[model samples]
Structures are given as C-alpha cells and as structure tokens.
Target: MSEGGSVKRSRCFPAALLAVTALGAFNAAAQEPPLIRFGRGFAAEEQVWLMSARPELTPNQGKKYQLKQILFQANPERFQAFLAGELDGGTAPGLAVIFARAQGVDMKIVASVCLEAAGREWFSTTYMVKDDGPVRSAKDLKGGTVGVVGIKTATDLWARAGLLNASVVPDKDAKIFPMGFPGMGDAVRTGKINAGTFVEPFYSAEMARGGLRKLFTAVEAVGYDHELLDIWFGEKFLKAHPDTVRAFLADYVAVTKYYLANTAQAKRDLHKAGFVRTPLEIYLKNADWKRDPAARVDVASLDKLSKFMLEKLQWLEKPVDVRQMVDESYLPRQ
Candidate 1:
C-alpha cells in the first residue's frame, strides 16, 4: 500500500508542476504591454519632453506601456515615415501636418507641442545674421538670400511673413536656401546665406557664440497666437490602439509638466540625450519650453496656418479642413 501511494504522489507532482508552469506563462503574457513607435524630428522642446516621458512609460511604470522613439533630421522626413507606416505617430510642424492631411494622409492632430502666443516669447525661431553684417532689419533682407530648414515649414512661413511685413516679397525680394538648422548660423556667418533661421538649442548655441544678431522671431512675424508644432498620430493607430493612445497622452502631459516644473533638470537631460551641446547657462538663457499643460489644439491657429499655406504660399492645392484634422478625444480629461 505504501509503495502504491508513493507512485501515485510522484504522478500527481508532475501534473501539478505542468499546471503551475502553464499559469506562469499565461501571467507573463498578460503582463506584457503593447509597444508604441513614435517619431520625432530634430532636438526641440517637444523632444525634450518625449525623452523625459520615456523612463516613466515602462511596462511596470506610469502607463505600463513600452515606447520607442525614432528620430528624423527634419519634420518632413518624420511625417513621410509616418505616412509610410514606419511610425505609429510623429511630431511635425503644424503646417506640415495640415498639408499632409490635405494630401490624403490619414492622421489626426492630437495635441499641441509648441505655440507662439502674444507675450509668450519663450519658444521661437529667430532669423539671424552676422552681428556686424549690413543687414540691419527684416527690410534689409530684400534681394538677399535667407536660409531655411525646409520649404513651407513653420520656419519658411515665419521667414516669409517677416520679410513680407518689411515690404520684401519672399520669392522676389529674398531667396530661401534650404539647409539644416545647425548649419544655419555658420552659413550666415560665412555669407553662405544672407540670413538663416535657427530654432531653440541651435538658437541658444548661436547666441552664445556671440557673433550673430536676431533680425526677427517667428512670434514677432506671426503675431497672433498659434501652434508652431503639433503632435499627430496615425489614424489607423488611433483606431487600433485607442487605449494605448490615451495612455500616451496622459504620460505626455505628465512629462510636460515635469519639464515645466524642473526646467534646469530638463536642460541637463537634453544635453545628456545628445539634443544639445551648449552649456546649461546658454541653453537656459536662449531656450524656452513654454507649452500649455492641457495640450489643447488651437483651431484658430490651425485655420490661420491653413489659409497662409493655401492662399499666401500657394504650397497647398486646396485648404484642409482644420476642424477634421484635429481629434481632441485622446487628450487626458481635465
């Protein structure tokens, strides 16, 4: 009887171990979270927030979701990657997003990354020239060449508006030479271009170098309040992963708050992330991380950009429905 009982217990032990192993596998599968691929362009305030948000989005952390950020050299490249299904979402200049939507890219403007409002001079793109150069003002750019990061982007639009305000026709009075933001200052300094546009970190670095002067800023050019950059998610991603999208926005808002509250720390983080090489003091002095905590999309600003793109620049064949392009449903509840 004892021998029979021992054999019976041995058989039951194997069965129990199998059940436990299967349960463990099931639990592990359940604990695994969905992965999100997000694309960002050049180092900017938004990218800083994104980098800060990354650590908090781990599988066992805030959102319990995994985030992967893909970097692109320019906004157009970022948007193109999103359209090609290489990215789940991306950051782009608001104008680029609008133009892409007009061209039938199924994407939605989920949040505003950066905005230029009246009295908010914190974040802006500056038109810079040699401090000792003959170009004293925007009007001086007439018949001169201006370097821009891209055509029809926020920088291009702002540069054109500044020149136009000074009675200089963008195409006629000034020619736009496309170049990288990092090279813009050197171009202006060496006369490769008459003036160049520099944003944020690059702007700060150039200012610290002490040989350039700002001719105008984007905020000064487009005076009324507007979004400079917007956060967009592919429509298919939104539809397929609504929960993940909501989680991402929540984490993004939290991270943005962290950025605003601890700006000094954020700047250090940006340097560590290889976004900027400038000293902290220089970055702090010239970089502005102003953003609305609610991450609300400004419809009025969107309308303004669309009108400028379609009517003024003639960059778009037709106006995009700004109202349709924005979907605020994903924003974390107030």
Candidate 2:
C-alpha cells in the first residue's frame, strides 16, 4: 500500500473554469434568493455531514447553503475554478493550494478540513502468477509491471515516492500501468501486473480474497506523516466577507470536534457522501479522521513532502512557497 500524495486546468483544467462558472452562479443565486450555493466534491465524509446536519457546521449562519454539485475532478481543476472566481469555496489537495498561489490564482487555504490520520499506507495483496513472474520489491523487478490508478493522484505519487524510498526509480526500473482500484487484484491474480497499489476498504477486500500480501503502507514507507485535505476560498470572498470566513472556520472546527466526539453521526454522513458502502463501522475500520486544534497548513512538513514529490516524482512545474498559500488568520485563535 503506497500512501501519499496543477494549474490552468482544462479537461486539464475544467475544475478551474468550472470554479469561475460556479462562482458566477453563486453570485446570481445570492442576489435573487436567500440560498448560498456550494460547489463541492467528495473528500472526507465529515464535510458533508457537518455542513448540512443540525446546528450547521459551516460558517454561513442561517443563510442556508446547499451542496449544489459534487465534481470528482482532481485538485488542479478545483483551484482553477476558485481562482477564476467561479467557486465561493471548496476543498482541494494541499499541493494545489501552493500551485494556485504560485500561478497568482488569488486563493488561499482558509482552514484544514480533513486529515488521514490513521489508515493503511501503501500495501498490496499477493497475486499468483506464473513461475516466470518477478519477485516482490523494486530490487527484484528491474523491468516488471505494476498497477496504479492515475498518474496525478496521491496513489501514484505515493507509489513513486515509495519506489524512491526503496532505491528503485519508477518508470525507469519498473513500468506502471494505469488502472482502477477494483482492477488491481484481478490484474495481479491474472499476472496482468506484478503488483498493484490498494488502500482501505479495497485493502481489506483484497486481503480477504487470500491471494495478496502486504507490501508496505504509506506510514511504513513514508513515516508517521499526515495527508491534509483543506477548504480553500477565493480571495474575493474573503475580502468581501471576512467575518463570514471566520464564522466558517469556527463552525468547521466545532463540527470536526463534534464528529470526532460523536463518530456515529460522522459515519452516517460518510455513508451519505458515498465514501463507504456498508455501515460506518466498516469504513472506520479502515480510515479515521484527525483534526488539529489549529488547522493551519503544516508549512514545514508540506515543504518537505512537496520537495520530495517534485524531485522524485516530478509532480510540480516549479517549487512553491508553502507559507504564502496558507492563511491561518481566519481560524480562531486559542
């Protein structure tokens, strides 16, 4: 299990354009109605539950906000929309925050929303192959094939990072094929791939199949690090309604604490958000969320992780200033 993980998005950056378009809709909607429309995507389940549940976790007050749309696009597109002023606010990957700022996108990370505190790192289930198949570890497969999701996803970054950690260069030493998570075990079992990266529910599913073996998870390979998912707002929104931003932060923090303290409610929300299929207990068995008292960007840790990704995985076009993208003033001070 490899764990881990944009700009001018088109299909390459639809999320960017979408963000701008989304924002215009919000503005128009605001003028005509009391509704506050939100363009969001699924990340951590808590966000949907807290923001919509009783006592609303968002800072929008009694204005009434609706999750207008949920797009599954990656970070770059989402931030692109924010920069274009189409989206009022949305969550994005940590790296996207830096990339958007570097490009002068006019957005800032206002609060840390979700944390992958405890979960499977990058581990694998064992798949049987013909005797000619290569052995486990990069050292054995100088020219073997492995399965990964998309090249730009966290899974890919972690896979490449894991390779670097193992002293084997991916794409140079081994070939990585793009495939969905569901196909990983099948690919390995049928010898379509040497190994595949699987996480959580998938991890437990593969394990139960009795063919896969654990390789190494993100924690085991990358250390006890955290994966941060955050809420980023357009600069325009902050300038126009700074108190609204502060209120949002307070509600966000309160909801996070509420969710952690009352997991059943959180799980119910997760189920609604479609992160888990079965009971909340099944999903919780794989992943748990963590909240920082102050959910500001962990600048130093992000820098280290970003540098590793850029140097090893060539994920970014240029280096970024983590501090500039992170504006913690909106979060309430203890």
Please tell me which predicted candidate would have the highest TM-score against the true structure.
1
lDDT of 2 by residue, 106-160 (tens): 7777777655453443222222222345565546655777677666555666666
TM-score attained by model 1: 0.88
For candidate 1, the 10 contiguous residues with the lowest summed lDDT are 56-65
Alpha carbon lDDT at 329, candidate 2: 91
Scored by CA lDDT, what does every candidate get?
0.79, 0.62
TM-score of each: 0.88, 0.74
**What value does the lDDT take at residue 99 in candidate 2?**
54
What is the lDDT, from 0 to 100, of the residue 95 in candidate 1? 84
Off by over 4 Å in 2: 1-39, 53-60, 64-69, 83-85, 116-135, 272-275, 279-281
Query: The CA-based lDDT of model 2 is what?
Result: 0.62
Q: Worst 10-residue stretch by lDDT in candidate 2?
A: 1-10
lDDT of 1: 0.79
